[model samples]
Target: MAKIRLADALVKILEKEGTKFVFGHPGEQILPFYQALQNSSIKHILTRHEQGAAHAADGYARSSFQPGVCVASAGPGALNLVMGVATAYKDSIPLLVITGDVSSQLKGENVFQDVDINAVFEPITLQSHLVKEPQEGIQLLKMTILTLKTGKTGPIHLNIPRDVLQMEVDQSLLDETVELNLPNDWSNLKPAEKLVENSKKPLILAGAGVLWAHAVDDLHVLAEKHRIPVATTYPARGVLSEDHPLSLGLLGQRGTKAANFAGKNSDLVLAMGCRLSERTLKGLGDVPIIQVNLDEKVLKGSVNIQADVKKFLEKIRKTPPKNTDKWLEQLSKHPKTHKIRTNFKKTPLKPQRAIKEILEGKDDSILVNDAGSHTTWVNLLIKALESPSLIFSGGLGPMGYGVPASVGVSLARPDKKVVVVVGDGGFQMTLQELATITELDLPIVICLINNRSLGIIRQWQELYYGAPFQVELDNPDFVKLANAYHMQAKRVDSPDDILSAVKDALKLNKPVLIEVIVDENEDIPLPE
Candidate 1:
C-alpha cells in the first residue's frame, strides 16, 4: 500500500463513508486538511462562522438521516462549535466534528491557537479523541462512525494535531472497512405489545426517534391499523400528516389544545421514540405510560422497552385493528378551537395572522423555525404534512439556528421547497449566512418576523416580573439588508399582504426574503 499524508487518507476515508459535503472555515493549523480537500470530490461549504458550520451540519443531518461532518481550527474556532455541538447532542443528531490542534511536541506550551479540545467536549459528545499519532487516526474515525450509527446517536469529536495531520500514513490502513454489530434484545417489547393490545382507549405519543429510526411509514401503519389517535412532541410534529384523522397534533406547553385534552384523558399512553420531557408531561395527570426507546436512561414510564423503534413497531403491528370509534368520536367532538383573525386590517401585522397566511395550503413545504416566542406561534399554528417537515431547536432552543439551518436544508433537498421563519432578534444571530445563501444561489424563502424585541422574554417579564429588561432590540431594515446580500426582498406590514408576498417569494428562482413587521405587544396565546 502506498503512503499518503494523514489528511489525504482522512479525506479518502470520508469519501468511502458516503460524505458529499464538508462544512467549515479554514485556518492556519487546518491548512493541511484544506489542501487535501482541493483534489477531493467532496464539496466544502465555507460558512461565515464556525457555529454556523456546526448548525448547518445539524440541519443537514436531521433532514438527510446521515452523519454530518464539520471542521474548525484550534482554540476559539473550535470553542464556537460547542453550542452547536451541544444542540445536536441534546437532540440526538449524529454529527462528526474534526478540529485541528497544536502539534504533539507543543503540548501545554501555550502555542498559538492551542487548547485541550477533548477535555472541553467531554460532556457534549458521545466520544472524544485527541490523535497525536498518525496511525491511530483512521481507527479512531472508524470507532466514531460505528458509535454514531449505533443506539442513541449523538455528536463525536476528533482533535488532530497539526503535525499529525501532515504526517504520512499507509494507505491500506485508511482503506480498512469497519462493520457495526449491535445486539438486538427485544425481550421487553412483548410486554409493551401486550399492554397496547389490552388497552381500549390507548394513545400513541410519537417523538423524534420516529424520524431517527426512519419508521414514519411503520408508525402510520401501526396507528391506522390499531385506530389509535397520535399525539407527537414538537420535534416529531410531522410524523403523520396534521390533517390525518388519527393526528391529535403536538402535546406540550406550546402544544395544540385538542392534543393536550386527548393526552390527559387517555388510559394508556404508548410513547415511542421520545424522552417524554417535562414540557410534554406538564399537565397530564398520572396516566400509565409504556415507553419504547433505544436508551433506557431517558425512559420515564410505567414500562420501558429498550429497543429500536422501527423493529418494535413492526412486531406490534401483528395485533388486528381495534374498534375505538366511540372513544375517537368522543374526543373528536371536543376539539379545542381558538379564534384567530387571519385577515387583520392593522398596519403592524399580528404574528398568528402572518403564520396562518404563510402556511395556507402549503402543507407540503418544509419549515425551519428559530427559537423565541415566534417558535411557539409556528409550533401551535403551522401543520406539517410529512415526517421531518418541521425542524426546530428542540432541547437547546438556540436563537440563531434558523437561517444557517435553512441553508443546509436547501443543500440537502434541493428539489423540495424550504422556508425559514425567524424573529427579528433571532434573525440577527446568524444573518451573515445570507451571503452563503446568495453565493450558492439556493432557492430558500426566508420569512423574517420583525417584532423589535425578544417576545418570549418580554412575555415572561410581563406576566410575572411586571417589567421588561434587556428584551428590546435595535434592528436594521431587513429589506435593505437582503438587498445588500444581492437577494430579492419585500416588506409586508399588513396581514392582507402576507399570503401574496410569501407566494411571490416562493415563485422566485433564487433566494428571497420577506420582512413581516409584527406587533411587539401582541402576545402568543396560552393553553387553557
Candidate 2:
C-alpha cells in the first residue's frame, strides 16, 4: 500500500481501466495530472482546443464501444466541452470527462479559473462527482468506470481540486474493484415474441443504443429471421447493411425515402434501443410501437421490454422466423429510394456525386461526417455495413466535429482506415486538429467538400427570405492549410478529378485531405 500522489493514482486508475489515450489540452491547473501521465502507459492526445478534445473522445467512444476519456481545466476549458459532451449524452455515447478545479478551500470564492464544474455538467451526464480528497476521488473514479461499463451508458464527469490531485493517497486503494449489481429477466422476450408473431407488417427501428450495445449482429439476426424491414435512426444508419434487402435505412429529417415510406405504413414498429422521439418517429402516424431498451424512461410503447437490446434480440432469435412477404411486396411496389442527382460529368462538383464516388464500392469503410447539408447527402448515400460505420453527431449536431472525430476514430480503429466526409462550413470548425492527424501519421482520408456557403441555411434563406447573410465563407486555401500542418493535401474541382484524387489519397497510406470544390448553389431540397 505505497503512498503516491492522488494525481499519480488517478493516472494508474485510468491504466487499470484499459484507457489507451486521453484527449485534452493542457492548462496550468491540470498540469499535476498531466505530469502524472508522463511515466504512464496511457497516451495523452493534445487537441488544439478543449472542444476538439471532447469531440475526438466522442468519436473514440462511438467506434470502440468503450468509454472515451477527455480532460480539461476548470472554468472556460471545462465549459468548452459542453457541446461535445451534450452530443455524446444525447446520442448515448459513453464518455468520461475529467476537469481540474480550484482547490477545496477556494470553492465559491471565485478563485482563478474556478467554476462549479459538477453543477454545470449534471444535466448532461449520467452522474457528476466532485472530489474533495485523493482517496475519495480514486473511489469515485472506480465506481464511475463501473457505471460506464454497465447499463444505460452516457457522459459522466469528475471534478478534482488542484490540491486534492497532488495530495498523497494509499496506492492499495487503486486495487479495489467496484462490483456490479446487474439484474436480468428473460420473461419480457415471451411477450415481445408474441407481438412479433401477431403482427404481419412489422418494422424494426434501431437507434444509437444498438451501437452502444454492440448488438448489430443480434439486430440483423432478428430482422433477417422475421423478414422485418429494418430502419435505423440517422446515427445508427449502419446497424444493418444499407444494401440488404431488409434494410430501409434511416428515418428522420435526414431520413431515406424508403425508410420514411416504410415507417409510415408499418402496422407494428419494433423500436429497438431507440427513444421514439419526435424526429425518429417522423411520418409514422399512430403506429403501435414495441420499445426495447435498458432505460425504462424511454419504454413508452404499447409493448415495453426493459432489457439490453442485444439480449432481447438474442432471446427472440431463438424463436421461429416469421414471414411478411405479402407486406414487403406491397411496400416494395412503391418508390422507396431517394431521388438523388447523379451527374458525375458536371464540374463545380455535386456533393452527392463526390460522396458516391468516394464510397460507392467500399461497403466496409468506417465513415464519419459532420453536421451540415453534407450530413443529409452522407446519410442518403452511405451504405453502412454495420453499426458505427456511419458515425456522426445526430442529436446535438455540431459543426467541426468531423476533423477531430477522425483523430479519435483513427486511434481506436488502427486496422480500418477512417473516411471523413465534411463540408467547408463544418470542416473549418475543427481544421486546427490537422496537426494532430499529421503528427500521429494516422490513416485518415479527409474528403473536404468545399462549397462557399452554409448550404442548408443558405438554401432556406434564398427560398424563404430571398436573402443570404452570414452564410458565405471567404475561406483560406485548404490545400496550403493542410500542407502547413505537414500533411499531404489535394484540390480537385471536376467530378472526373474526384476519382483520381480519392485514389491518390487512399494510396498515400498516411493522413491526407482532398478539398473537393462542390457546387455552391446546389439548391438542395428538403427531400423525403
Candidate 3:
C-alpha cells in the first residue's frame, strides 16, 4: 500500500502495455516525466522538433504495428506537433501523445507557455483529455491507449500539468479497471461473402488503415486466394511489398500507371481500410465501390457494400472471385510511367534522376519527403525496401516534414538505412536540427533537391496563374552548413556525376547531406 507519484503510475501503465520507447522533446514543463524515466524501463528518444516526435512515433507504429508514444512541452511544442497530429488523424495512424502543461493554478491566466492545447487539437484527434488530478493520470493513460484500438484509429492526447506529476497516488487506485471499447466482431462476413461471390474483376485497394489494422498478412492471403491484383494508397506504401507479383504498386494521382488503370477499369473495387480520396478516385463516375472501414460513415457514398476489413476478408475466404486472368492481363499491359525522363545535360542535374540514383544505391532505405516538387519525384520514383518503410506528412504535406520525420524514422529503425529527400525551401524550416542529428548520433542520409524555387506552387502557377511569380529561393551552402554541425556532406550538380557521388554517400554511413542543384524551369510531367 505504498504511495506512488502520478508520473510513476503513468510510466508503469505504458511499460505494462509493452511501450518500448517514447519519442519526445524535453523542456522545463516536462522535466518531471524525464526525471521519472530514470527509474522506469521505458526508453526516451529526444527529437529535434515536436513534429518529428509525432512522425517518429507514427513511423514506428506503422512499421511495428504498435501504439507510438510522443510527448511535448506546452505551447509552441504542442503547436509544432499539430501538423503531424492532423496527418495521423487523416491517415488513421494510432498514436498516444502525452503533453506537459503549465500548472493548474495558472490555468486561463494567459500564463507563459500556455496556449490551449485542447482547443488547437480538438478537430484533429479521436480523444483529448486534460489531467487535473493525480489519480486521473493512470486512468487517462489506459483510456488513451485503448482508444487506438477503436474504430477509425487516430491520435489521442493527454494534457498533463506540472503539479500532477509530483502528486502522491494511492496504490488501490491502480486496481481501477478502464474499459477498452475496441471492435472484436470483425469476424462476421455474410455481407462480404455475398459481395465477393457476385463480383467479377474485383480489385483490392489497401491503405494506411491496413497497417493500423495489422491485417496485411490477412490481406495478402485473401488476395492470393482470389487472384486479386492488389493496389495500395500513397500512405500505405509498403503494406504489400512492391516486389509481390500481386501488388500493382501504389494507386492514386502520383501512383503507378498499372494501379490507376487497373483500379479505374475494374468492375468492382474492394477498397479495404481506405478512404477513397480524390487522389485514388482520379475521376469517379459510378465505379461500384466496396468500402470496408471501421468508420461506418465512410461507407455512405458510391459504396455498394461495407464491413470491417478483417471480417470482410475472412468472410470472402469461402466465396471465391471469378477468374480475372483476362482482366489482370489487361492491367499488366498498362504502360509503366514510373520512370522520369528529363533533359539535364547542359544545366543543373535532373532532380528526378538524382532521386532515382539514390533509390538504386539504397534500395532498403527509409525515404521521407518534404512539401515541394521533389515530393512529386520521390513519390513517383523512390522504391521502398521491405524493412524500414516509406514516410511523409501526406495529409498536411508540411514543409519541414522531411528533416524531422527522418530523425524519428532513424531513431525508431536505427538498424536500417534512413534517407530524407527534401527541397531547399522545406529544409530551412527545421535545418537547425542538423545539430540534433549529430548529438543523437543518428546516421540519416539527406538529399536536398535544391531547385531554388517553390516548386509545387510553381506547378500550380503554371497550370492556373499563367506564369510563376515570387517562387524563387536563394539557397545556402548546404555542405558548409552540414560541416558546421560536424556531419559529412556533398553536392552534386552535374547529371553525369550524380550516380557516382551518390554511391560515395551510401558508403559514408554517417549523417550526410547531398544538395543536388536543378534548373528552375524543369517541370514534372503530368499524364496526357
Point to the candidate with the largest lDDT: 1
lDDT of 2 by residue, 1-528 (tens): 579999998898899889999999988778899999999999999999988999999999888989999999988999989888988888878899999988889989988888888888999998888988787888888888887877788888998888999999787887877776654555666777777777878888988788777788888788887788888887777678777898877786667767777788887888888888878767465887878888777778887888788887787776653569998887677554566777768677887888778776333568888988888787666667766687789788899998999889989988788889998988888888998889889989898888988999998998889999899999999999899999888998887777777777777778988898888988665754
TM-score of 3: 0.93
Worst 10 residues of 3 by lDDT: 181-190
lDDT scores in order: 0.85, 0.83, 0.77
lDDT of 3 by residue, 149-180 (tens): 64568898888898888788887777778886
**Model 2 weakest 10-residue run by lDDT:** 180-189
TM-score of each: 0.95, 0.94, 0.93
lDDT, residue 308, model 2: 80
Candidate 1 deviant stretches above 4 angstroms: 181-183, 320-322, 336-339, 361-363
lDDT digits (tens) for residues 10-116 of candidate 1: 89888888888999989877889999999999999999999999999999988888888889998898998998899998888899999998888996788887787
Candidate 2, residue 143: CA error in Å? 1.9
Q: RMSD for each model, in Å, please? A: 1.9, 2.1, 2.5
